[model samples]
Target: MKRMLLMGIALLCISCQGIAQEKKEEKKQFPITKTDAEWKAELTNMQYYVLRRAGTERAFSSELLENKDKGTYVCAACETPLFKSKHKFRSGTGWPSFDREIKGNVAFDVDYNIGYARTEEHCATCGGHLGHVFDDGPKKTTGKRHCINGAALKFVPENE
Candidate 1:
């Protein structure tokens, strides 16, 4: 009877562990909060162009767009942290691209405005559109080009 009780306890522990793992994932995926007017006032005209208007930055025009630094990228509109430096890659597309985001930090929508199928990225917090993503990216890793507008992001340099 003691052995049976021990096995039951072990099963309970495993179940609780699973629940904790799921909660962590849930927290990561949730969006941050902000208003459109607040973002407009906080960001500049250029930032407003790209982030709020879905405007694309001119090729090779942004310092952070090509920044190869060790840091995280956050939404210039709302300061919601998004991608990590590790996910950024040299796409040679004259824009900053990332293979992925910093988990639960962003959102995507289908863009067909150009009569082409593409994925549009956005700040999950304010629903502010950022840019598009493509599959024809780096061959070595996740073949995704998070072709972001430089105005949409702000680079937070790593302390180390």
Candidate 2:
């Protein structure tokens, strides 16, 4: 009977260890990670504030709002390709707006900074805060308005 009891306890311990291992595996680690000092050194003041601290840029302040060129928008922190020029549209929100992001390059989370839940978007590689997404977009496409901060992105012209 003692041997049987010992075996049962061992089985329970094994199951608990398996559960712990699964929980550890479920946590995500980004491909790009930098120390806070390194990030601050690499990014401009506004970029660091917006991307790392989740600060919003003033509306209509971004030159990207007026850009009509053919290019791709990359994460300012990690240079990960995020949005294409073709997906961009004038949301008139004064920020650079996109209809969609490059698949698997962006991650979404919930934000309640204003006392309501909103879908927040970030760069998948470095987990930099890009901006929030909304449903108010042109109905002809994906119906997602990925309203992004200009400071969080760097445009690469297609020719380059």
TM-score of each model, paired residue for residue:
0.74, 0.82
Residue 68, candidate 1: Cα error in Å is 1.8
Which 10-residue span in candidate 1 carries the lowest summed lDDT? 20-29
List model 1 lDDT by residue over 1-160, tens digit each: 9999999999998767454234232322335544568767887989987877788889888888668889989888777888899999888888888998876767887766797668888888766678898998787888888988887888898983
Candidate 2 regions exceeding 4 Å error are 1-28
Clashing pairs for model 2 are none
- Candidate 2 per-residue lDDT, tens place, 1-160, comes to 9999999999998777544234233444789988899999999999999999989999999878899999999999999999999999999899999999999999998777897889999899999999999999989998889999999999999999
The lDDT for every candidate, in the order shown, is 0.80, 0.93
TM-score of candidate 2 against the unseen true structure: 0.82
